[model samples]
Target: MGELRLMKGNEALAEAAIRAGVDGYFGYPITPQSEVIEYLMSEKPHERTGMVVLQAESEVASINMLYGGGGTGKKVMTSSSSPGISLMQEGLSYLAGAEIPCVVANVVRGGPGLGDIQPAQSDYFQSVKGGGHGDYRLFVIAPASVQEMSDFVPLAFDVAFKYRIPSLIVSDGLIGQMMEKVELFDPIPRLTDEEVIARYPWATNGKPKGKERRILTSLDLDPHKMERHNWALQEKYKLIEENETRFELIGCDDAEYIIVAYGSSSRIAQKSIQLARKKGIKVGLLRLITLWPFPKKPIEEFVKNGIKGFLTVEMSAGQMIEDVKLVVEGRAKVEHFGRYGGVIHSPEEVLEALEQKLIGG
Candidate 1:
């Protein structure tokens, strides 16, 4: 009940970034996500809260800008769609290797290679898996609605700064372009320069006059040192899996089957749950809020309850199904149904797939 207003997903996310005390944003324009920077530009947060919003020359420049700003302990962020995000892979790898904390949001569009501007979940593998070179993982959060589009900006920044790793809000074009009633959160004050330097001792905040020089880089000449660093990164990922994983279960207590999905797909599956229940199917929905950790624990728990099967619905060509199958490990029937390259399935279609794929039709 803080402040109620109706807003598009992209606009709300921009306002949320300002209220979240973001230090700066660096991004280039792209379809389905251009609204993000447009909103920021219209607002002129530089005058409002002293937040710097800049449109970089390209996506590659934007990501490198993130690395530079984040290295100094600033809460920097960026937004892009599929192809724009693809240009950022190398920069993302550099940020991870340096342990710089920042947030990147991908309002996904259909693509293996510049496929379409329409909403699609085809970036599932890139978001969750290591899209760039080397051993690393992004803390991936999937927001299902416009409300989440507003709510998760600060949440992503908090998690990013907490773990000192890159965090991504992996939303789709549907959520980015949709409009809905949302209650906005109260604004938080931006951290002072002194506060930032003090809070992150590792940050290269001008070396603090008399303090020891701090250098932030991803390069290591020694093989043994690099090996140790890689091991440390894995241990950090394990800690995130243990601590920051999130998901939601609905009507699951008495369900005979479950529909596993995330982002916009989860929103569709929720209604499909109602349709399945209307027909006395006794099905439930498992909405994954965190994509990287995969929520294996809940799926494994449902398996123990003797659930008949799990149907994973996505807007991709069976990418996430691999994880679902790996988790199920043949203990139950797991199958996938999807409409890729910019096609969105209806609730009836999802229910039909559920009945066919998991209900043994």
Candidate 2:
């Protein structure tokens, strides 16, 4: 453990990446997250730890660089905002198809097409529901606080390499720009080439003695072979769903209504929960940590345990509400409240929506 420092979220993420012993970082400049690369560049992790940092020509080039580095079993990552992330989708799909392990952070902003650089959760669907083509999923982690922004980078890389899948840190402009006290960790040593080889034998680092050369690709001309690959991916996802679903339950044990949220919305919802509690309304919060391996069973359990209804808060036009409804079925009422296009709802507004939609209704 190192001394606690008040740091911005994007800077914290960069510092943590260096401490986590990431092998490389490639990305273009994007608002609300430019500090990630800026910090890395300023710190010069290459001098300190042999890490490589490069500003790519575009998001497309950045993601491809990630593919090249990840295919070689090096810990690599990139960070971008909404539109910038969209540019990387094709590469992401290819990475998923090829089963490359890497981390991508999306500091979300208002969006439909190059929307404003303000905090928004509008990218919820794109982040969790596969923005690219093909039946693939990114292990999505929504970090609400600046502390979590620092913590989730290494966690994302760990899980990504463990499962050999691409992982996403789904954040918002609010979290990215906000500053908070964070306890930094000591630096971890980067893996040696021999260690990389032992850990990821399938990596295309080099053909070792008596070992076949590994081909890294997503293309399969044979339909049967592609189907088999898809099947394997499906199995991996199943295991992830079973073992990786993560969430935080607050005051749900004795509540009549539940609010579902993630990322910055979760922080707002937490304040709303306090307001509701002060008024003697039994409101609780279910904050999602992992968005893709959505905590479905927990939500289902809440419904089964006789919770009255759910109000899903987001910065989008009710994207995650679909997942909540899918899990709740018709057993309980589910409603949505959002503030989109660079707008954010206050705690008072969220509480009012909860009272009107779930309680008063």
Whole-model Cα lDDT per candidate?
Answer: 0.92, 0.93
Give the per-residue lDDT digits (tens) of candidate 1, residues 20-44.
Answer: 9999999999989999999999999
Candidates in order, TM-scores: namely 0.99, 0.99
User: Which stretches in model 2 have alpha-carbon errors above 4 Å?
Assistant: none
RMSD of 1: 0.9
**C-alpha root-mean-square deviation, each candidate:** 0.9, 0.8
Backbone clashes, candidate 1: 0
Flag regions of model 1 displaced more than 4 Å. Answer: none
